[model samples]
Structure formats: structure tokens, C-alpha cells
Target: MDHNNMITKFDESKYLISMAPVEKVLEAGYYLNLNDQSNVLDLCCGYGEMLKLWGEAYGINGKGVDICDEFIKKGNERLEQSNLNHKIDLVCQDVKEFKTDEQYDVACLIGEVIFGDVSGTIQALDPFLKEGGKIVIGEPYYKQKDVPQALIEFEGDLLTLEGLYDTFKRSGYYVSYMAGCTDNEWERYISWSARRDLEWLRSHPKDKGFDNKEKWIDTWYKMYFNYRRPYEGWALFILEKI
Candidate 1:
């Protein structure tokens, strides 16, 4: 199967697609101060939950860009059924290549889609934000300075919390509101992810990459408990374009 197909399966059971504090997701959405007229651009929006939340709670109009057509189609259908189709649109496309001439009141990059780095992401997304608009980014961070070589590929070489501030300033963004995932939350999310992988493998034991995937399951848990758990974190940060 292609990479996107695997992604669809791996994340099929997930709704919002972030390990960040789930309740805080809505709080960060509220910080956008959206209304019926507000426009949001959600990059890598999974299952369209963010837009759905904003639309239902704050009555915002928005567009979501994701590479998964299955996800986008389901989201669009639900929106149409709820009489929300007029306000929200979900398009299937690689977010990095997504384009639009229109500017939005808020631009969001949530979960697993930072194209290069946070700074590069800000530059790529800056052109789409209105002058006073806010950008909400939710992703992982390296919690410790001593890095594990094995985790780097999956870790994204993330910034420490302090370094993130420097990065925000470097990208000409002003930090507004932020929420960090608790250790309990991280443990819960990681364990849940492992469970999902295990469940997939159990039913598809004969799948082509079973051996490789099985190895990953063992490695992931081993690395998490030993290296990642104490040294990594997820957070949602709202930034203002400076």
C-alpha cells in the first residue's frame, strides 16, 4: 500500500489526530475569537473535528485541507447533513502544496504536518493570514537536551519549550496562548497508539510488513518508556503574526 493508505489506516480510529490535551484544543479554538464571519484554514485537518468544533460552538466559516479523501468526504457529508456545508469545506490535497489567494482570520497547523520546521511552517503559512489573525500550532517538543539518536527520525528534532519561544520570535510570531500536554496525557496517548498498532497487526498477521511492523511495536514502546516518555511533550501554541 501507498504511504497515504497506511496513514489512513493507522489513524483511522483517531478523531482530532493530536496528542495534545484534548480539552485544550477547543480552548485554543476559542482563543481565535471566531464568529459567523471568521474564516479558518486548517492544514492537515484530521476528521474535520476542529472546524466542526469552531463551526458548532463559535459559528465560523472555514476550509480544511487534508490529503485523505476518505476523511474529507466523510467530514463534508456530515457538514452538509448538519446544514454546515455552506460554512465549511474539506479538500483533499497535500497541505504543503495547498494554495489560496484568500486570507483567513485564523490559520491552523495541527498534528503531524509541519512541512520543514516550525519556523519554515510559519513562513509558508504567513501569506495566508490576515494582519491581526492568529495561528494555532499543535505538535510535539523535545523536553530534554540530551537526545536519543534512535528517536530523532520520529521525533522531528523538536525544540525544547524554551527554544520554541526563540523559534517563535525568529519566525516573527508573538506567542499568545499555549497549553502543554501533561505527562499522564502523553502516557495515555502513546499507550493508545501502541494498542491501535497491535490491534491492526493481530488481525492482519499475514500482511506484507507484519514482521517490520511487529518490530516497530516493540521498539516504540521500549523507546517510549525508556527515552521518549520523560524527554518529549506535546503542546498547542497560539501565535500572532508579527
Candidate 2:
């Protein structure tokens, strides 16, 4: 596969423009009994967007951690720009290795799971939760089978909804509720992302080593963006530690 081209196209277009899903998810989480005294940890919190949204609306003290330095940096910058920097903390650290001196009332692992080495990933974050704490996980169910096709194609370890819930259960966590997003979420996501990505590619022509921008664009629209089974939509599993 043309990794460079693929990365360039996806990052430049899909990543740059997508925001509705995060907003919608935060809206959903906000109504779930969050409060001012709540100490929240946003696992895999890319750019702290969710943290900012929830923190501002709910008065929750939020801290975010992501494996990507760029994400951490951008998150900090956005928090500062919003004048909520005092309430938000950003950490650039690997999720599997980062340790916290404090526990949180609520924790989130939103849309950033990449599938490999997940057992360790689950174990690492499990300790950060306070007793009976809540954890909100976001995942896609783009296929009907036990495994999602996107996961297999990307060499990702696909965890079924039952499997993930089971992992939490064996760890003494139980599901509180599960919500299915609208199909519009997925459609809007692809549409926005594809547009943003094209702009990013224009500005970052040489960043990802893509020599043929046209071919990159073609592959993205043809295979990557156009792929994926129609499901309405992603699943949000709200789990509570026992």
C-alpha cells in the first residue's frame, strides 16, 4: 500500500475538518451526570476538544493525555485561546506508560483506539479510575461480523462490543448504558474530513512524502473514504467500575 500517500490524504483532508462527532459525543456525555467537582481524564484525547467542551459547559476540571505530541501541543494552544487553559491540563505521553498520582471520577477513551496491544492498553488505564468511576468508550461497528473490516484491513485488533464489555466486566466494571449515534454522524464525518484533508494536503505538499497528490486523492476517495459498511453509527459504551 502507498502509506505515505494514504497518510497525507487522510491527515490533510479527513482529520482537519471533522468536528461534529466530537461535539455530539460530548453533548451526550455532558448529560450523564457530570459536575463541577468531577475530575475527568480524557484518554487518547486528541487536542483536548472534548475536555474543553465538557469542562466549559459543566465546570469540570479536565486533564487530557495523548500519544501524539502535536495533539498535546494543539490541545494546549486551543485551551489557552479559549481562556480555559487554567482549568485544563494537557500531557504528551503514551497512554500505556503514563501514570497519574490522582484518580478521576470520570474517564473517557474516545475514538482513538488503534487496536494493537489492547489488553495492556485496558490494564494501563484501569488503575486511573476511582472506585465506581465511570468510563466512556467510543468505537465503530461498521460490519455485522464479530470483527470490523476496517480493523482487519488496517491490521487493527478488532474488539467486538461483547468482547470489550467482557474485558471491563472481568475487571469488575459493568456497563451503565449504551447509545447508538445517528448515521448522519458517519456521513458528516467523512464529508467534513475529506474537505479538510484536501486543504491540508495543499499546504503540506511534501510533509508525508507523497510524490503524486492526484493518485493519493484518487485512492482516498475510491478506497478509504468510500469504503466502510453503513451502520448507524458508532457505539458509546458507558461503563462503571465496581
Candidate 3:
């Protein structure tokens, strides 16, 4: 069914992939006090919207890596249109294998922990961060401990806010700042994503993956609406290496 391709199609034209509100994203950059001299690295940088916004806001230079070719292409187009291609570099590659010799003033893994574990991902990213640099992570936390088993399986070892903080602290990082998504914001994101998928499904009824796409959309909508929306809390955490 080319599930990856279908998902990419569903996400077409969207900017931010995470549950974070656009204002929250801008607030994160402001909280970090990023300047023109700041160099940023964004892993799993979907469509490069956050980096582009930061570049325009703070004049920061950034490098973004994502595995989606369509997203990278769109990001490049946006950069070129904004005359920001020289300021920001967008590459299509799996972040786990993305290598860079230079260190960054800021590194981010927004809503994606491709390294399979949050602590492990942070450890892997540590070498790319310059001294005193900040790392930003956008992740979902369990709102309560007694979530459904299916939801828990979908989320994979999520923790409470306190646990998330302790994880960073134990990993030798300090939590400098955090911004959480409002319930309204989370609902809007999920609803919008599901709507987009439904719209695509309606328009592509004759496509080879039609049945699979429809099933995927229905299942995803049910899972998110019935479980994630009520039990999951999403947040952006800014950490500094201690």
C-alpha cells in the first residue's frame, strides 16, 4: 500500500507536523534568545517550517534533515521562494545516519525520536551541540498512568511530566524552559490532520491504495479521537547540557 507515501500525501501542504501551536513554536525560539549568530540543527524537520520561521525571526542559520523526499522538496521550494536557501540547508535523509562535523548552538528533535528512546536520542544528539547549547524536544506525555493498553502501545513508554523532567536531569541536562499545547490546540491539530486525510481519500477514490488509505485514516481517527485526545499531553521542552 506504500504506507509512507500515503502518509506523506496526507500531510501535503501542512507546515508543522507536531501538536505544538504555531505561537508556541515561535515562543520556543524567543525563549531560547536565538540570535543571528546561532546555528541550529533540526532532526526530522518536517517541511522545515520551524527552521524557516526561526530564520526569518532571528536570522539564525539552520540545517534540517528529514527522511521524506516530498517534505524536503517542499522545504527547499519554500526556502528558495523566501531567498533563504543560502541561510538554511534542507536535506532528505534518515536523521539517524545524518552526520555533521560542526556543532550547533541549538539542536531539536521535534515530536520525533527516531533513535527509539528519548534518552538515547538525546545522548546521540549531544555531540552535535556546542558547549552551552540548548536542545529542544517536542513529545507527548501520558496525562495519567492508567491509560488504555492500546494507547500505551501506540505511545511506547511515555512518562508523566515529572518523569520527563527527571529523565533529562538524570541524563545530565537541565530543563531551562517548557511550553505545553493547550487541549484546543491539540484537538485542532488532530482534527485537521484527519480531515486532510479524509479529503485526500475522497479525491483519490480510484487510486490503487484507496482501500488501505481509507482503512488507515479511519483507524487513525478512531485512535486519536478515542484515546490520544483525552489521555495525551504534548509539550516542548528546552534543555541545556549540564
Candidate 4:
């Protein structure tokens, strides 16, 4: 049973996979003071909702890159429907291989640090931005400095909030504005995610290939409820290149 595929199937219905709520997403864009002249690049942009929101709110133009074909296809459809196809372009490609000669006012790496080391990824993206351009990173952090080693390993060496700040500073960026997801927001996200997975299981009960989905949900529920909710935190950090 492919557990990763099961989880992806579970999250197919969600627009934002991160703990950051819609309000927070909009607030992040607002803090950037984006305008019609702003050009942004979103790396690992799942479904391109953030770009769409910014396009509508601030009339910003951007490009989004993601490896998922389904997400890119759906994002383009949404952009066309909203008449924003000209404002934002969604491309299906690995973010690591995505390159552009154009520089952007903002570079976003939202909720995707788990794919690689946060510091390395941020440094790699610096060249794509114009001078004084801001970078937005949405990542998970340990609630306390003394978390279990196992949990830290599970998170790919997740840092504390202070450590995260220092990492950005060392990477030649300064933290300007930060927003942490509230406990209620985390609960809401997890609950909705579980519900969506359960709905999928119910609708596909006869599919033998997905028989493990139920177990996957149960395991994920326990991990979130018993582990992550108690010891982990998620935040959106707005960083200015120093």
C-alpha cells in the first residue's frame, strides 16, 4: 500500500494544505503591500491559491511551479474561470529544476521546507529575486526546544521559532512580520483533513487498492492528536533580504 498516495488522495479536496488559514494567507500578501507592478514567484505552489488570492486582492502578477499535474491543471482552470490567467501562470515542474532569467519582487516557499533543508532552499531561491525583494516561508517549528529526538527527526530537523529566525538571519534575511497558527486553526485544519479522508474512504469503499486508507487515516490522526498538536507549531515568516 502506497501511504503517500493515500495521503495525497486524502488532501485532493483541500485548497491550502498548510496550517495557515485563508485569513493568514491574505494577511501575508497584505503585509507585502503587493500591487499591480509586483511580480512574485511561488515555489512548490500547490493549487496556486495564494497566487490567486494575491492576484485578486492586490492585482499582482506571479508564476507558480509545482510538480503535481493535477494541482497545476486545476489551478489553471481556476485562474481561467476567475479571468486571472494573465496575472498568474501555473506550471507543472519540479521546483528544483525551475529556472527563470526574470527577477521577482517576492519569492515564496510556503509550507514546503520538508522537501529539503530550509536554509539551503532559501539560499537557492535568493538569486531569483531582485535586490531588497522579500521571501515568505511557511514552515513548522517545535513548540519547545526540548522536544523528543524522534519527533525532531520525523520533521526533518525542525527548528524552534528562535532557531528559525536565526537561520533566516544567517541566510542574509531579516524577519519582518511573523504569524503563528493558533491552536484552534491547527485543530480546524486537522479535523477537516480527517473528515475529507474519511469521506474519500466512504465513497470508495469497494476499491481494494485503497483498503489501507483507513489505517493510514487512523495512524495520521493519532500522530497529529498525540504528537504534533502537543509539541509542534506552524508559522508564516515574512523575510526581507538584508
Candidate 5:
């Protein structure tokens, strides 16, 4: 399996699971903060969709930064369409290396975390928060024996929601808001997921094949089941720094 091709095929699900439906995630963040007006920092913001949604729908504006140039370009175009080019700032650079002079009321990472080094991941956001500001992290939790060996070996470190919460606590942050998937509407927003998986399987033809692959998919789906899945997958935690 060509890793690059796998990424290309999986981009949609990556976007779907991690990026799509930013409007609802943004609303959740806003509701958690109890404000319609607040500065937002969308770190790891691929294409700035969240910023565009917030600006266009709720009249809020913020900054979005990502490591990918294509994402930044698309994000700029989206902002332009929303006529929010001036309201939102888009940066095409490693967010960890980027610095903002402005302090934000809220910060969000509505995609995958626990990739790369776990402690380093949390520490990277240290400079972005304003005093009393809250950080919202969208995490996928699950139950059963769903965690994949591939994810642990290839993707990055995997942590349960409880583990993540405890990590934040140890970092002097308190969990303030947690949102679990309840509407069964998550699937409605993710039609492209099958395409992504198929592409991955095609790119990575192997003897191990669909047996392991189906298990991989099932692992995530099992996460959706509240009882069988670990602490429930797709949870958003709002944390305030102590």
C-alpha cells in the first residue's frame, strides 16, 4: 500500500470524521462558552471551514492555521465565498511554529489528536490560550477491543477520552464541556467514508486484506455504540487552564 495514495483516498473521511460539520462543532464550542461573540483560534484548521462557518452563520471571526498549503488555499477560497476574507485570517504554516500576537477567547482542534508525541501535542498549545480562555478538543473514544495495531504502530499514540481528560488535568487544565454523539446524524454527514476506505484498501493491497481492514472499520464503528464502545466515541471536551 502506497502511503501517499492511501492519504489521497482517505482525505475525504479524514475531512468527514475530522473536519466536516464544523458548523455544529463551532456551535458546540460557542454554546460551551455561552457566547455568540468571541475570538476563536482553530489550530490544525484544515481549509478554515470552521472559521468560515462561524463567520458566515454566526457573525464571529477568528484565525485558522494548518500545515498544508492546499488546505490553506481552499480555506482562503471558502472565506472569499463567505465574503469573510477580511474577517478571518488563514496561515499556511506549521501551527506549532506559528505565533499570534492576538489572544483568543476560545481555541479548538476539531480533528484527530494523539497523533505524533502525546505530551508534545498538549504542550504545543501552551502559548495559544488567553487567561480564562477555554480549549476545546474533539476526541474519538470507544469501548470493546477496537483499537487497531496499525493505528498504534503507524498513526500515533491512542488515548481514551478519560486518558485525555486526565492528561489535561495534569497539565493544569480542567474539563468543562464534553459532547457525545447522540443524534445518529454523524453518519448522515459522512457519506464519503466508504470511498475513503475503499481507496485505502486498493492502494494497500496485501495478503492480510479485508479481514484486518474490516476489523479496522468495525473498531471505529464500535466506538459509536455507547455501551459497547469505550467511553463513547466522538466526544468534545472543553478545558480551561488552571
Candidate 6:
């Protein structure tokens, strides 16, 4: 018997922009008792993928805040095409300056939360969430002990999984559920990143980093497979305010 956990690969790449796959994203959404009335705020919503997933699956009304104009414009355009136009919206604004008196039922800090590590992120988003509200965070953590000093320095904000859970607890939040990024998902992200970076180098031959881009990519892959992949991992965490 194959005792190992099963890996599910998606044919399409719509939700493949991040380390977390579509199923995991959906699972995170299902953790919330959302309805049409439930408001979700995504603090660093890249292209608003999580918002779109939750809105479609759980009938959530979402507001996404992203600093990228392109991300907001594209996300809003996509929202306009579907019934979600009224249900979801994306704003291009610095998360720190986003002022709203409306406390959300769910607040997300997916990919990279601006305030830094897990503890700081929780503190930053706390004001936006209603009492006992949920926070869905996509973050990286040390998967194994004995991480190299170089890697430890590189991933300055990351803590071990146990450390992260402990931090969550100390911050007055209950870790409801966590969905890890599969090995396949990490590979998929690495491959996509390589392709994207190489394409940029090809288009900008005279760019300052063009010549060293290949070396950078090679080093990145080496670091990923040899060090980061085994030692570090990303996960979508469901944290409920306690």
C-alpha cells in the first residue's frame, strides 16, 4: 500500500500563480461560514485570486487591497465579466493607508503580508477583523529543523511550523486549520517563476541583471531543491480570533 499522501495536479493554471493549489484555496474558503452578507478583506491580494475563489465558492462579498495598479485593473476587469462584479471589488492602495470602519468577517494576508512576520501581520490585520473573525494567511515556514544559517538569514521573517503555531496562540488566535503546499505545487511555482524570469531576460537583453539572470535562476533552483524545498514550506493557515 502507498501510505504516502496523494497529490492532486490541476490541468489549468488560473490559481497556480501561488504555491497553494486550487483545492487548498477552496478548502481555505470553506473554513469560513460565509454568506452573501459576509465581508472578506484581502490585505495583499495578488490579482484577487483568493477573493474570486471565495466569492464564487462561498457567496462571499470581498474587497481586495493591492498596491499594484495592474493587479487591481485586471482583477476588476475580470470581476466585471461575471456576476461577481457587484460581489467583489479590488482597490489599488497601500494596505497601511487603507481606511475603513467596516470590520470584516474574514481578513486575508495571503502571499506576503506587508507588516512582516506572522505576529506582526496578525497585529496589523487585527483591527480590520470583527470579534472572533477568521484570518486566512498564505505564508512560508521552516518545515525542518537545522536550517542553514544562510537560509535562516534569507528567510528572516519565517519561523518553524511549531513556532508559527505557538506565535498564533500567543497572539490570542486559534489555529483552526492549515493546508500545506504540496511538493508538486512548489515545483509548479518554481517552474512558472523560471519561465517568467527567463522571458523577461529575453525581452530585455541589455538590462543590468540580464547577464546574471541565468546564474540567479540556477542558484535559485539549487537553493530550492537542495535546501528550501526540504527545509522550508508554504501553507494556507485558517486563524480565528480568540
Those runs of model 2 whose alpha carbons end farther than 4 Å from true positions after fitting are 1-24, 114-119, 146-151, 155-157, 204-208, 212-217, 224-226, 231-233
Q: Candidates 1 and 3: which is better by TM-score?
A: 3
lDDT of 1: 0.80
Number of colliding residue pairs in model 6 = 0
lDDT of 6: 0.81
Itemize residue pairs with steric clashes in candidate 1: none
lDDT of 4 by residue, 104-176 (tens): 9999988776347779868877888898899988888888888776666656578888899888888888998
| lDDT of candidates 1 onward, in order | 0.80, 0.66, 0.85, 0.84, 0.64, 0.81
Pairs of residues at least 3 apart in sequence or in different chains that clash in candidate 4: none
In model 2, the clashing pairs are 12-197, 13-193, 13-196, 13-197, 13-198, 14-193
Q: Estimate each model's TM-score.
A: 0.86, 0.75, 0.89, 0.87, 0.67, 0.89
Which ten-residue region of model 5 has the weakest summed lDDT? 223-232
Residue pairs clashing in model 5 are: 1-204, 142-229, 142-230, 143-229, 143-230
* Model 5 residue 168 distance off true place after TM-score fit, in angstroms: 2.0
Candidate 5 ranges with C-alpha deviation above 4 Å:
1-23, 32-37, 114-119, 144-157, 182-232
User: Could you give the candidate ranking by lDDT, starting with the highest?
Assistant: 3, 4, 6, 1, 2, 5
Candidate 6 ranges with C-alpha deviation above 4 Å: 1-12
For residues 1-242, what per-residue lDDT tens digits would candidate 3 score against the true structure? 89996674344425777777666777899999988999999999988988988887789999999999988999999888888999999999989899889999999998876787779878977889989988999878998878899997777779888888888988899988898888777877777777878888889889998888888877887888899888889899999965
Question: Which lDDT value does model 5 have at 158?
Answer: 53
Where does the lowest 10-residue lDDT sum fall in candidate 3? 5-14
lDDT of 6 by residue, 1-242 (tens): 33332331343244335788887787777777777789999987867877887777788998999898977887887677657979898999999899999999899887774786788899888899888788888788887767888787766647778988999999988888888888888898888888878988889988888878988898879888787888889888889864
Q: Write one digit per residue (lDDT tens) for candidate 5, span 1-242.
A: 69995774344334433523444565664665534477888888887766666675566768888888978897797678768888788888876677868887777776555334434555666567677877767665443335655444542455676677677878788876676664343563333454566677888877567678767766555444433233335666677765
